[model samples]
Target: MSAALQIGLVLFPKVTQLDFTGPLQVFSSVPGAKVHLIWKRIEPVASDSVLTLTPTTTFADCPQLDVICVPGGFGTDDMVNDAEMLDFLRQQAKAAKYVTSVCTGSLVLGAAGLLKGYRATTHWSAMDMLAPYGATPAKTRVCVDRNRITGGGVTAGIDFALTLVSILVDRPTAEMIQLRLEYNPVPPFNSGSPDTAPPEILALMQERIAPARQRRSEANGRAAARLGGDVAAG
Candidate 1:
């Protein structure tokens, strides 16, 4: 039998539930694909008191991955400042054939020093954080730069994962999965992107990101120190 394409999805406490679950659904729907939840510990982690997931393996116990996926949320804010977590992400991402992130998960990848000189995207509110890692921020919901792929905001994971399937497998396969999921989306609000959003809504999003930006700045600092300040060279 052919080996399954092993996909590792990184999970942590307070992660944005949709960022991981949406992609999980897309990837798991693929034939001969295996999804493994990887975390610092092999236990259930909660997502901001909303959902819980039991990790299939800790980082140390994980198998070699064909793909390494990172999801974003408040947990990512914490991960960006965590030395052990950053190191883990850095190593795993470096070794994986494909590295992907969802939402502000791009921030975590940036913090891990993986996006340097790459084209990437993240939650619109958090796109600025990619600068330090030498990435050009894209406004699109999904971006693929060489081996790295990134998705913007919460619901972008499904699109991102479907894109990966198209790349790694075939467009027909992706279309089949999309059809299976009834993937055509009709949003009630046309404000998914900043350009289409009402000024007040855009302002509110910017305002809400203030604290997160501050925390990301501090976390970037800490991550740099732990890496002996090599991030700037990227």
Candidate 2:
């Protein structure tokens, strides 16, 4: 029998829970799939929300994964500069069939020098940050460029995973999984995106997140410098 498809998602402090959990929920349904929550050590990690997550494996003990995913959140500020985490991702990407990210997780991949010369995407607010890592940022819900797949912002993970399912298994199987999960989304507000949100609301959010964005920018600058890329002050 064929070996089960091994999937690993990196877990870190202050992660945006939905970034990984949404995809986890979808991936769990894939037949013959084995999922692992990876970290530097096996312990409970706090997320941006009230939810806490535990790692199933440590970097040193993790088996080679078929798919390696990074989920983004405020935690990425630390991850971008984490030597061990970057090294682990680099090692895993060498053998992983797919290197992917959700939300700001793409920034972590970029820090590891994995997204160089790739087309990727991240949260709309941080789209401009990808260029320093040699990645061309695409504005979309889910962006797939060759083997690098990225999901934009928080809730886009579900869409990203469904798209990946279609590729990893088959469209029929993906459709079945969607149906089984009743994955129909009907958000009451048409304000999910900056393009759709009221101007004041968009401005307010941008203003509120500016500090985090600046921190992320500074962190990316350091990581990029380590990779011999141009460094820009935040």
Candidate 3:
């Protein structure tokens, strides 16, 4: 029999745990598929301010992977600007069968010169940052540009992962996993996002997230200058 498909999940401090865990659960449901916690080193790292997770592999020790998944959070602002981190992503993604991301993870890919001329999406609040990275920032929750797949916001990771399962294995398998996980979503409030949120709530969210956004935007500018490529958002 063939070896199990190896999937690597990138980890960094301050990353939204849900962005990693949501897709991790769905991917783990598949048969003969392995998921590894990847990071710059082997250690436990905390989420943007929430939970902590231990990484299984580092840049130098990890084996070749079939898929590489990047998750986003405030930490992405850091990763997107790290020359070493982005270079690693570019190398692994170039050889991987698929490269995927959730939330602002697409921004990391862009920094790696992977999203050129590819339509992609990220958290709506962070979409504007994509332009400088040479990607056409899309508004959709899920966007697939060739082998690169990206999702918007933290919750969108679930949907994107199910889609990936369908693409990599089979639709039947994907559906079965979805059923097993009870993937249905129900928001307590009518305002999970800017459009659905009341004006006051939207303003509040923006106010709260602005500092991180500013950092990400600055990192994007630095990355763009380093990469020297055209922005493609279509």
Best by TM-score: 2
Candidate 3 lDDT tens digits, 1-234:
189989989999898999989999998999999889998888889897757899998988877888899999888888987877887887897689998899999989988888878888999988887876668888888898889899999999999999998899999999999999998888799897788899999998899988867877888888787777433341
TM-score of each: 0.92, 0.96, 0.94
lDDT of 2 by residue, 1-234 (tens): 189999999999999999999999999999999999999898899999999999999999999999999999999999999989999999999999999999999999999889999999999988988888889999999999989999999999999999999999999989998999899999999889999999999999999998988998998888878776433431
- What is the alpha-carbon lDDT for the whole of candidate 3? 0.88
Q: Which ten residues in a row have the lowest lDDT in candidate 2?
A: 225-234
Which scores better on TM-score, 2 or 3?
2
How far is 203's C-alpha from truth in model 1 (Å)?
Answer: 1.9
Residue 4 of model 2, lDDT score: 95
Q: Hey, what RMSD does candidate 1 come out at?
A: 2.1
Q: Which stretches of candidate 2 lie over 4 Å from their true place?
A: 229-234
Q: For model 1, state the Cα shift of residue 199 in Å.
A: 0.7
Task: Order candidates by lDDT, high to low.
Answer: 2, 3, 1
lDDT score of model 2? 0.93
Better of 2 and 3 by lDDT: 2
Model 1 over residues 1-234: C-alpha lDDT tens digits?
A: 188999989998899889989999999998999899988887789996667889999889888898999999888768877767777877887678898999988878877778878999998777766776668999898999999999999999999999999998999999999999999999999998888999999899889878877886777666545544664454
| lDDT accuracy of residue 203 in candidate 3 | 93
